[model samples]
Every structure is written in structure tokens, then in C-alpha cells.
Target: MTKAPVTPLLDRVHTPDDLRKLPKSELRQLADELRTEMIDAVGSTGGHLGSGLGVVELTVAIHYIFNTPDDRLIWDVGHQAYPHKILTGRRDRIRTLRQGGGLSGFTKRAESEYDPFGAAHSSTSISAGLGFAVANKLAGTPGKAIAVIGDGAMSAGMAYEAMNNAEQAGNRLIVILNDNDMSIAPPVGGLSSYLARLVSSGRFLGLRDLAKKFAKRLPAPLQVAARKTDEYARGMAMGGTLFEELGFYYVGPIDGHDLDQLIPVLENVRDAAEGPCLIHVITQKGKGYGPAEEAADKYHGVQKFDVITGEQKKSAGGPPSYTNVFAKSLLSEAEQDNTICAITAAMPTGTGLDKFAAAFPERHFDVGIAEQHAVTFAAGLAAQGMRPFCAIYSTFLQRAFDQVVHDVAIQNLPVRFAIDRAGLVGADGATHAGSFDVTYLATLPNMVVMAAADEAELVHMVHTAAKYDSGPIAFRYPRGNGTGVELPETPQQLEIGKGRMVRGDEKQGRKVAILSLGTRLAESLKAADQLEAKGLSTSVADMRFAKPLDSALIRKLMATHEVIITVEEGSIGGLGAHVLTLASDEGLIDAGLKIRTLRLPDLFQDQDTPDKQYDEAGLNAPQIVDTVLSALRHNSAGVEEARA
Candidate 1:
């Protein structure tokens, strides 16, 4: 058991109001204490460490400068809000972060009044902030809307779209660009600090205002020339000419870590009565922690770690993750087919495309935080006679639904969607759960959807997608390590729209049939064992494809079995829904044979262990047995009631 580090200043802060009471000079010490507390808390809980570390000072400065709850301060992608959580009346529960019934990893509206808008997805904060700002203006409320977004988030088109429309809110909207790359600002030292102080102060802006008025009075041509010259000069000094063109008053390229620089600038921005402003603040991802700074990812997300050594606790060695299986399998396919390529939206490593990138540098594309562009880009590649795999997380892929429908499905393109994280992603909560991908993609006219039952099946699916050149095809796999099944030496392309019976023959007096999609096959097999032990003959089948479901297999199961049940790890409109629709359409259930569908419940499940979540959804082995027994009992009772 690890003990928390001493945090004297942080201990004093129960909320942002407590933070606001402290003098401006004491803010740097508070920020240090806050960073320590954040590091210690995340070290125990194992969550997004680097992002929170990056924004420690900024989080402190904002709360100190602005009256939050009243003034809407939204954190984009919310992974960076751990420190913000610690300061905003959640410090006691900070250690329980990402655990069951504990605090969420992202900002949630239900969690706190301070978090006006919940966010786990990137590039949404600007638009949400604009909504708040416009609503406040209409209501005549004395509040401002501030959106703190990252540089990576700005790559998405939605961020720019929000920026283009930002003038509507005028002074009510504020956009703070947290540039971790330090691309927008000067190096962190004397010159950057000096420049930041001068610009944030009233005197510098007063002179600039005077110059602007004088320039407006000049001849039209001279004024235009002067404006261009001024824009160019500012662009050379501070990199925000593009933001200015999008109708925003561009400020800074300031040192985000320096409290003296940060506090004054935030104070200035808070007091300013002008149009929308974009303050470009440079920050380091892992500013304070030595181990985090030294790491390649800057420990963007971490597991439990030793505070002294910063050595993360290693997981018990097991089978390779589904992500690794896909990457290796895709690489194998690419070796044989040179035209095979991979693309991910700012998640090369997350999607295992980093392995592909390393192997095939020219063929791998990392379209930074742009899922919509990634989908269409793959379509373009497929259009030009190349096998393109758009590897994106199922949750993030929702951002490209329009492109998936319009550019890929409607056009009948051969772009392969390698959807990872395709089930309840534990700890990320409802926002990041890959629940709807099956329903969304299976409903498409020209789309083919498949789910892997295990790592070996994932390899086969990868090969299938590579060889497939018909229309849009997708294959989904979950987040964690695969079940310890032996991998095939070579990849094999599975027959599309087919399923295989894993247990029991049709003539074996099969009274109960369990049809499983995705990784729930193991549970189904276990349920079959339990049913067989109870003198109930049962059959289990693994249905690989959800879109082009094995109707023949369904018909065979329905004919042979007295009771049939469909199981999947996805939400309601997924495999179970498809199976039910098939049974109805084929008139298979007209004989009144008992049938049941087990799926994730209608509500968004909160963050918990994957096993616990599945258990809660009643998709486990015991639940499956209970469903079958319950269905049989109901049928018997109904028949008895009719006879009476």
C-alpha cells in the first residue's frame, strides 16, 4: 500500500472558492502542491497522467482568475481535468478515480456544477462553449464561456468551424489554446516571460488600440497596407494570424507554466470586453515529474506506479492483446500485398498503427485527430486501387459516420474499417464505450460487419478485410488482451456471412441453442456446459458476421432447438436485434418456439471492470442459463394456463 505525498497547500483548497481566497503570489506554490497531489492520485489510480500534469498551472490560474460555475470553463477531451477535479470539491474522492462508482476520468455535467459541459471526445469544447456564451447573452446572465482546448484537438475541422462562428458571442467567448508542442510560443525563459508580461499588461494593448484607430483614419489603400503589415509583424512575433483571420482577437504565445505570466494573462482576458480571443499558451505535457517527462509518451496514460521510481506496476504476463494481433496480422497481409495501407486519426499507437507505421512508413497515415478526414482519405485510397484499412477506435469512429455513409458506403468503396475498442471500454465510462458501432455500421446498406471471437479470429478477420474488395467492410475487437488461444501460424481469410457450431450436433437432441457474436463465445460455451450438466442438451455457435448474418445457421438452430438465445457484447440494436429481425422475417418463430435475446441494457453503464459490467448486463454464463430456464418455465406455464 502506497501513502500519499504531503500536500500542504492543496490540503487547504477544498474548492475553487478556497483557491480564489489565496493571494496571487501564493499561486505558484499552490500549483506545485496541486501537481504533486495529481501525480500521487493518478499513480495510485492509474489514469491520464501527462495531460493533467500539463495543465496544473493553467487549471489553478483559471479557477483563481475566473468565478467558475457562474463563468463556464470547459476542458476539451476532459482527460486533463484531474487537477481541475481535485480543486473543484472532489479532492476527497480523487483517489477513487476510474474505479467502480468513483469519479469519472473525464469532466461530467452530472458530477459537478463547475463542469457545465461534459467532454471525453476532442474538438467539441469550442462549439459547446459557444452555445453557453450565446445562451448566457440571450438570458442576460453575467457569465462568460471559456474553452481550454489542446493543439491536437485544433486539427479537427469542427474546432475551426466553431472558431469561424465565434464572433456571434463577441466578448462572451474565450478560447485558450494549450499548445503542448510549444509551437505557438517562444522558448520557456527570460524572453518568453518578458514578452508575455508586456502583452498581457494594459499599456501594450493601449498603444496597439491607439495605433489601430490611427491606421483606420489613414487612406483606404494605406490602411489596408498598414493592416497587412501589422498582421504579418504579429504573425512573425506570435503565431496566431490564422486565428485572427477566423474573426478572433489573437493574444499571447505565452508561457503556460509560469504563474506570473499565466495569472496576469488570464486576468486580462477575464476583464477584456472585446470580441472572441484565442490565447495561445505553451505547456509541457509532463512538466514536473522526472519519469513522466523522460518517457516517450510523457506517460499520457499510466498504470499504477511507484512514486519514488515512477515504475509502473506490470500486468501479469498473458496472451497478446487484440490490438497487437491485428497489427501483426495486418503487417503479414501487407507483406504479401504492397498496396495494403493503414490510417489512424491521431492514434497510431492507440490503434496499433504505430507498428504498421514503423514497418511501412510510406503506407501508414496518421491524420491527426481527424476521423472524418481519415475515413474519406481511405475511401480515396480504395478508389485508386489500393487496399486501405482505416484503423480507428469504435467510439472515435462515430465522428466519421457521415463520411462512412456518404464517401464509403454510398459509393460502395472497399475501405476497410478496423474498429478497435468495440465493446464496453472499462474506466472510460459511457462516453468512450464502443456500444453503438455494431448498430450504426450493420444498418448501412453496403457495409459488412464482423466481430472477432478471439485473437486467432481477429487475425482471420484482418485477412478477410484485406482480401475483400466489394463494398465497405468492418471488423471490431475489444480493448484488452485476448483470451489465451493459440495463434495460427499463417492468416486465413474466413468465409463471409458464415458461422461455425462450437458445441453439440443438430441430431444430439439439442433442446437449447446459444448463438453468440463477438467475444461472448466463451461465456456461451460455459453456459452450454452448465445446461448440459442439468440434463438439458444444448448447442453453441459463434456467429462471426453481424451484417450478413448466417441465416442458414439461424434456420438450422431454430429448427433443431426448443429454445434459442442470441448473445453479444454490444448494445440493444446490434447482433441480438439482427437475429430477432431475421427470425421474424423468415417466420422461424411462428411455431411459438421460445426465443430470447441478451444484450447490454438500454441505459449507459457507468465505469467498472469489464467482467462486472457484463455481469450487470446479465450476459454471463449463469445469466444465460437463467434466461433459458426462465423461457422454458414461461412456455410451460402458458401452456398449462391455456389448458385450464
Candidate 2:
């Protein structure tokens, strides 16, 4: 358990080509150094730790084996790609992971040549890898394409779809199914169970061969024969299987961490000139590290930690986070109302619903990582007169947009969406950013969208969503701690589509006005104060509801202020777009009132601290103040000089 000093090998690796030159024996030493550096790096900046540790050897082996810049290797979900980042020429920038203008937490094509394919979301790697493989074949390039996907990710329909199509295309492709036995938590669903059995049985080389025992004695064809034999055996052994029917030549149940086992099997799969192949390699979640191996989920994503003790660095703070508050409030409501129920798409602890699950086991549902099913399931429960609260991360909810539109919104189901991680999520980068939900959900006909200003507001939103049986209701709150706001004794429902004025002078000569949404209210208030100090009076309104635009408040602000600025945490089609649409309808533009909307830029914002990200997006206090002043000066110049 001795801590090794960060060595020169760690320092020198700024690219994969550099890594390819080193001897295979030196890789073990490099992996040890990489693990130490990763532990140390993530210890300082809170980020995903255990996944990176689990993939160290596999990452090393793949980069060493494949001609990376030419041969594309796609990583699924990107959470586990931290070590991949380190070895693939981003080692020097590793310290800057998740910081503004720093290294991204996931695979990004723009970041390096090694990351030929970028991924932030789960269940996307296989499809992306197939694209690369097909492209390589068309170009007649001397390159290989591989997808290192986990067993948990394979449960998703998209991966299977890719496998079906890839096998039919008959391209030389390799798929390494990294069976880590955990996906954030112990993986769920039937696919996970089948994979577990696959691991236990160890590749089905002799399920029942009518052809002969010598098929097992054959070299490359052994995998093909085993899959054919296993398919027939599975008809009677369990149920008629789905994978081989899809056409993928399934191999493995190999030990992933065993370099000897992994290298040769991968070599065999690589050498074989045939259709799509899957190498199912079983690996413990936290292979090399002891603490991570013991507590896989806890170490899944960790804060700066003491490497020796495996204790996360504590931030001196107070009170429950918004997520915790929402969970507690929901549980309290569920206790009183039998009709109240909760559903999460694979996230239990992350959404803080573990408490609710403990209290009301019957009402709690974890629908694996299937967001689409989670939404429709909530809708179904609502149809039966139950108030179902579907708690999911804002980014994840994007995957179920069609369900929200068709099933819940169209039917006007009483489904409450308690959306966590609503705003700028730090470190995880653009792939995990919850920036588009406000826009996407707000436009739906019967849907109600609300954002929490603080923990207290989140409590109210939770109560509001629970009690109101009108239609589908959504309440969004940002990631991390609340602003130390005291929670109400009991939740109170706010009037729908009504906005609360945060700061403004009723008599001030309409110099400026700001309508803000979500957690960005604090920054807007600060900017208003700064604008007031400079003899530039300003008003700030918290447009709590993104949907059902607060028309009364918008009209009032338009009448008073000469300049209007809308601010929100989401992207192009969000709160700002709604504001502009309202303005155009009211003919505010023709009235010569200057208005500008501020939001996240068109391009993806890289990994950074949340505050830094907002600042970069021009949503911070200084940026807001500067934007207002500049707009005012431009207006005054055009009018005053011409009148003079």
C-alpha cells in the first residue's frame, strides 16, 4: 500500500504514439504510475475515479495494440474513459480535467486524435464504432475499429441494434464487452443476468456440438462453432437467445484483467477476417485498487480523496442539498398519500431517492438505465389515478423527449418530473450538460415547467408537482449544494405561471430589467446590485416557470424598462427563446425598446467548475453588468445624437 511518487513516464506520455513505442513489459509499470497519477489528480478535483482505475490495463492494451489515429476506438458513456484520456496524449492536461479550457472528463474528438469518436451519453459507443468501421471499409484504409462497452451498457436497445446491423454488414469489427459487474451500482435488467450467466459458464465452447468435439480443437473457427452450438443449446437450456439471432459472433467470458488472457483473445479476434465479434471479458469494477473494489458505486465518482484511507475530502458545509430535500419532501408526501409513487431510471442514490425506496419499497421503481421506459411507466401509473414522480437527471431526460411529448404531455397525465442536475454540471462536460430540457419540455402543449431558485423553492416545486393533478409537471434544480436557505416546515404550492420579483424599483426610469431562471437568479441579483451602484437602475424578476410564459410579468417589465435582458442556464432554444417569442408577439421590437437574450453558446462548453462555465457563458454578475451597460450606451448613441 505504499504511495509511489509521480514518475517521469507519467510526465512524458502526452500522446498515444509515444505510448505505442514503449515495451509491453513497461506497460505494467506505466499502468501503476497512471493509476497513482489518476488517484492523485481526481483527489484534488472531484470526478470519476473507480471506472478509470478499472480500465487502466484494457486502455493500455488497446492503445498499444491498435494504430489509434488510423484505427478508431470508441468509449461508451465516457465516465470510464479517464485513464483513456491519460494515455491518449492528454496526460499533461489531466490535472485540468473538468476545468474551463481544461481537459474534458469524457472522450472528445476535438480534444485529440486518439479520441476518434466522442461520447458523453451511455449506449452510444457501439453505433459510433460501427460508423467508423464502415467508413474505414469504404475508404479502404488500413485501420481497425473497436468499441470497449460494459455489460450494463449492452442492455440498451441501441447497442443491440448496432450489433444486428454490424453483423449483417460482415465487416471486420471487434467489440470488447468489459464486464465490470457494476454500472454505477450492481447492474439490473435481463441482459445483465444473462451476461452474469455467460461469465459463470465461460463462453459456451461446448454447449452441445453435433458437428464434432474437434470444432473446439479448431483455431479461429472454434469461436464461430461455439456460438452456433450455444445458440442451439440455449433453445432448450434457457430460452431461445436473441444475440446470435442478431448475427454477432459472440466470444469470451474471459478474465478482463488477466493481461495474458485479454491480449491473446483480442489478438485472435483482431486477426480473424470475418463479421462482427464480441469478446466478453469479466473484470472487477475496481481491479487494482483495494478500496474501490470494495465499494464500487461509492467510488464510481469521488471527490478529492486520501488515497491511503480512501476517504473523500470533506467540504465544510451545512444543510441537505436540493436533491436530498426533494427526496425527503417526496417521501413525506408519499407517506400521507397512498397514490404517490417514485420512479428513477437506474439512478437511486444520485437522485437521493434511496431514502424513499427504504421507506416505501412497494412504490419505488428503478427501471434500469432506460429513460424511455421510465417516462411511459410513470404515464401508465398516472392513467391508473396514481401520482407518479419520475425523478431523473435533466441530461438523461433528453433521451425520453418523445415519450414526454407523446405519452405524458399529450395525454395530460399527472406525472411529476423531479429533474435533478438541471443547470451547468461540473467536470462531466457538454455530454452531461442539462442545458436543453427547459426548451424541449416547455414547448409541449400540456406540460408545466418550473425551476427552483433555491432549496426552499425546490421543496415548494416538489410539493407543487405532487399535489397538482392537472397534467405533466416538471421541476428542475441544479447539481450540488443549496445556498444555505432554510427549508419550509411543510411544502406550499405556488400559483402556476406566476413569477416573483426578486429586485426592482417601481419608480426607477426603466434603465434596465433582467428576467432570470433556475439557479442563475443569484448571479442576476448580484449583477442588478452592481448596475444600481453605477447610477444605472435595474430590475430583476425570477421567471420561475419556463412554460406558460409569465405574460403579466413580461408585459409589466416591457412597459417599465427601456432595455430587457433574459438570462437562463439552458441553451439556444430555452428560456431566452421563449422571451424573444413573447416580445415579437407583443410588438416590443417595433416599439424601439432594446432587448437581448443571454444563454449558453452554440458550441459545447468543455469541463470546468460550474461558476467558471456560467462566467464563460456570460451569465455571471460581471458579464451581465457589462452586457447591460454596453447595450445602453449603444441605444443612447443612436437616439440622443440624432435628436441633438
Candidate 3:
């Protein structure tokens, strides 16, 4: 049996202020308790596990050394901030992570004053930290900005962009490169630890400043040579030549887990009267927990699990997830056509491209966290007569919208965009919800946008995208499993801009027409059933394409039905906006014709279950029925009571 952590030191500590009161000798014990507490908290409430566990000692060290809430400390991606949250007066609500009205899975500004900036995305910490640093400098404040960025996040160009401009911040900016997975440098040891201490030391910086002044008196050539010699000598021992080139005094390859090594080095950087510094700290993901250390990626984000066994709770059997379905469909297509290639921006497993990579390693590309590069790369492949499916999460794809418009859409390349998670993502919350992709992509010229109604439709859309090489095409699917729809053995290549009737059409003389987009067809049908019970005939149509709307179907519905309701699993400027434009252009709305739209609300929804989220957004079945009734001069109170 694992020994329970003795948290006498931890129980007394409710905040970082409490932690500063304890002696440095007791910090190691506090770190141990913090680790145990984090693991136990995440066990009851599933969330990001490994990253937070990896940063336990670092979190303690930073908080203990710096005056938090005054000195800004930003964690890149915010997945590693749980331990930091625990240390900063949120230990009581630790178990309520990712639930409705609970602590957010990522760092949230509204939740605490300690979080200076809200961050859930990767590689933005450096830029945000620089803003804080420069703002403090301009105000002539002693408070510094510290950004702890992961190695994976460094793959993006934004981090480098921030680093190149970090000179203005000078001594006010401190960047800690958290090298956990990528061994960017040699292993950390006593020798590496000593160098980090020396380089970051006040005495070393003082001497370095004195040397720079002395070198300036010589010729420009000698000055250049002296600088190169000093930079190269340190660069050879450590591995931050690239960071050094970006106008930062680079230090380290220090062991992050050791508080003894961390505390002093941070103190040196904190007290230094020099330019912006980059400290490279090496840590292991899932450091304290045994099972997590064995399988870091699996524990990176997890469902609830047993504390001792490290066995995650297996989800009850259901239909295949939309991601797996897309992967399978893509792999099947690639098997038939050698020209088909798969590209993912550092999310092979999340996008289900790992299976494709395992089979056709040559055709698979895992571009590390750089969505812009991934989009352009796919465009290049497509321009060269290859069918490259750029599979990215809708939120991540937003990072590359410029490339999508300039490189793919304007050029009219045959880059098949597989947009995963195209709606409200449950536990990941607002930062990860794919709410804006349909609105953004549909507005772009020369782009075909389609959303899958079910798993079978997803299979068909995949086949459709692979076959169509005329222009840039995109297909979006939700984040969860399908509605237990049967998998099609032979996937059909759907006709572009055409829709199918899921219920009664114009022939039935329906008074109510429910035009649905994406996976909202299921809920629309449910609304139709309630409408039918209330002595009202309702028609449901699954409009597959959002960009190239089936004008004939929409025109017919608007002319025949008295009440027309458009429902989609996206934001306001999507299908509803397009349909409104269509209606105004053609003057489709006749006398007494009512039109209503059901979509996600304007405000950003917080963390909750998928059902609760949809209900809150007013996109569920009852809400759809209510929208239809409200449009018509009918009693909507019946549906409201049923919903209750």
C-alpha cells in the first residue's frame, strides 16, 4: 500500500503567503504534500494530471521565491497550473475542477487575482508575460513577469516573436523553458546545476556588464569577436544558442524537481540587474506518481482513476467517437489512393491520426504545435497534386486562419480540412470550444464548409473531400461519439451543396420547417416529435453544407411553411446568418411568415457536461421546440413544462 502523505505543513498553508512563512527546510515536505494532494484531487475529479504533477516542485519554488499577485507569473497552456492553483489559495476547491461553476481546468483570471492573464492555449505565455513586464517597466515598478513555457509550446513562431522583442523588458522579464519531453540539451546534473548558478549569479552578471563596457572601448571588430567568444563558450556548455540569439541571456539545463537547485537559481534571476533571461529547466512529466511516470502521455489528460492502481475509469461502451471515425475513413481512403496524406498540428492521438501514422508513416506529418506551418505545408502538398487532409481542432485551426485564407482558399488549393471538435467541448471549457469555426470558415471566399450530421455522414464527407480536388474543402464534426449510427461499409461521396430530408417535406404541407445543420438534426427530429404530438406538422431537413446552401430546399421550405427555424451547433454568424442573407436576397419571407434561429449564445459558456452546455446554450430539443412555438402564435408553455 502507498503511504498517505503527512500534510501537516500543507494544511497550515492556505496560500503562498502562508508558504513564505515556513522555513526552506520544510518546503521539500510541502512539495511532497502538494504532489499527493494534486494526485488525489485529480483522481476524484478527472483533469490534466501529468503536466501539473511535473511542475509541483517548480510551482513551489516560484511562489516561494517571488511575490505572487504582485509579481506576474504566467504558465503556458495553463494545463500545468493546477499545482500553482493549489499553492495560491484554491486548495479547498481543487476537487471541483472542470465542473459547472467550479474551478476551470485551465487558469482563469476571473477565478483568482493570482492569475494575471487568462491562458488555455499554448505558446502565448511569453508574449503575455512580455506585456506584463513592459507594462511594469513603463510604470517603474519592481515587480517582474515570469513565463514558464513548455518545450512543445516553443514550436510555435509566436514564442520566438515574443523572445525577439524581449529586450525592452530587460531585467523585468524572466522566461523559464520547461523542457520535460524534448531533450533539447544534455542531461541535467551537478555540473549543469553549478553552471546555471554561476551564469544567473549577480557577480557573473556584474562582471559580464563590466566586460561589455571594456570591449566597447576596443574596435567594433574586436567587440564583435569578444561577444561571439563569450556567447559561444557558454553555448557549447549549455544549449540555448537559439534563445541567446533572440536577445536573451540564456542559462541552464537545471534539474527542475530539485528544490535545492531551483530556489537559488530563481533567486539569482529574480535579483539580477540584467536584460531578459531564459532559464532552461529539465523536468519529468508525472514525476511523483509511479503509474503516471510509466505512461505520461496517457495520463496527460485523464478520466477519473484509482489512486493506487492508476487505472482510469473506462467509459461505458458506446458508438465510435467522431475522431476515430474520421481517422478510419481517412486511412481507408489513403489505402485506395497513394496520393492521400494526413497532417496534424501536434495532436496525433487527439485527432486519431496516430493510427494512420502507424500504418503509413511516410504519408503522415505531425507538425509540432505550429498550425500556420501545418496549413501552409498542406497547401503546398495540395498544390503539387497530392490530397492532403489538414486535420486540426477547430480552436487550433483558428490560429492558422490567415494561412487558410491566403495559402489555401485564395489560391483554391485542394487542401481538405478535417475540422474536429466543431462545437462546445464539455470539460475543456470556453478556450477549447470549437464555436467559431463555422462562422469564420463559411465567410471565407472559395471555401466549401460541411458539417457531419452523424458518423455515417462523417464517413461520406471524408470520401467526398478525398474525391473533390477542385478547391479547398472542409468538414466539421463534434467532439464526442456519434448517436449510435451504423457505420457505412461503402462510404458515399456526397454531392456538394445538396441536403437530405430526414422527415416530412413540402408534399406533407408542413406548417413548420426545421432546417438543421451539423449534429443538431437529432434534436430537431426530437422537437418535431413534440410538435407532432401538439397537433402541428413539422418537417426536418439536414442541410449538410453550410457555405454552399441548397437554395432549392431552403426556398421551398420558406415558401410552404408558416414557421421556419434554423438550428446549428455553432455561433450566431453561421448557418442562421447565411439563411438570413438568402431570405433577404430572394424575398423568401412572405406575409405572416415567421423565422427564428437556434444557436449557441453570444457569451462564452463555462465548463459543464455536454448536455448542460447545450441546454444552457438553448440548442437542445426542448429549446428547439420552444423557438418554433415562439415564432408561431402557439402555447410554448407545454414544451417548457416538459423540459422542466
Report the C-alpha lDDT of model 1 over 302-361, residue by residue, as the tens digit.
899887899998989999999999999999999999999999999988889899999999
Model 3 lDDT tens row, 153-262: 98889999999999999999999999998559687779988999999898998999999999999999999999999899899889778888999999998999999999
Candidate 3: C-alpha lDDT? 0.92
Superior by TM-score: candidate 2 or candidate 3: 3
What TM value does model 2 have?
0.87
Return the top candidate by lDDT: 3
RMSD of 2: 5.4
Which tens-of-lDDT digit does each residue in 251-368 have in candidate 2? Answer: 5455556565555556656665546767666677766778888999899888878877888888777867888888888988888899999999878999998999999999999887
What residue runs in model 2 are displaced by over 4 Å at the alpha carbon? 1-30, 182-230, 233-241, 504-511, 588-592, 634-644
Provide backbone clash counts, one per model: 0, 5, 0
TM-score of each: 0.96, 0.87, 0.98
Clashing pairs in 2: 14-89, 15-89, 43-304, 98-607, 98-608
| Best by the TM-score measure | 3
Give the Cα lDDT of each candidate: 0.89, 0.79, 0.92
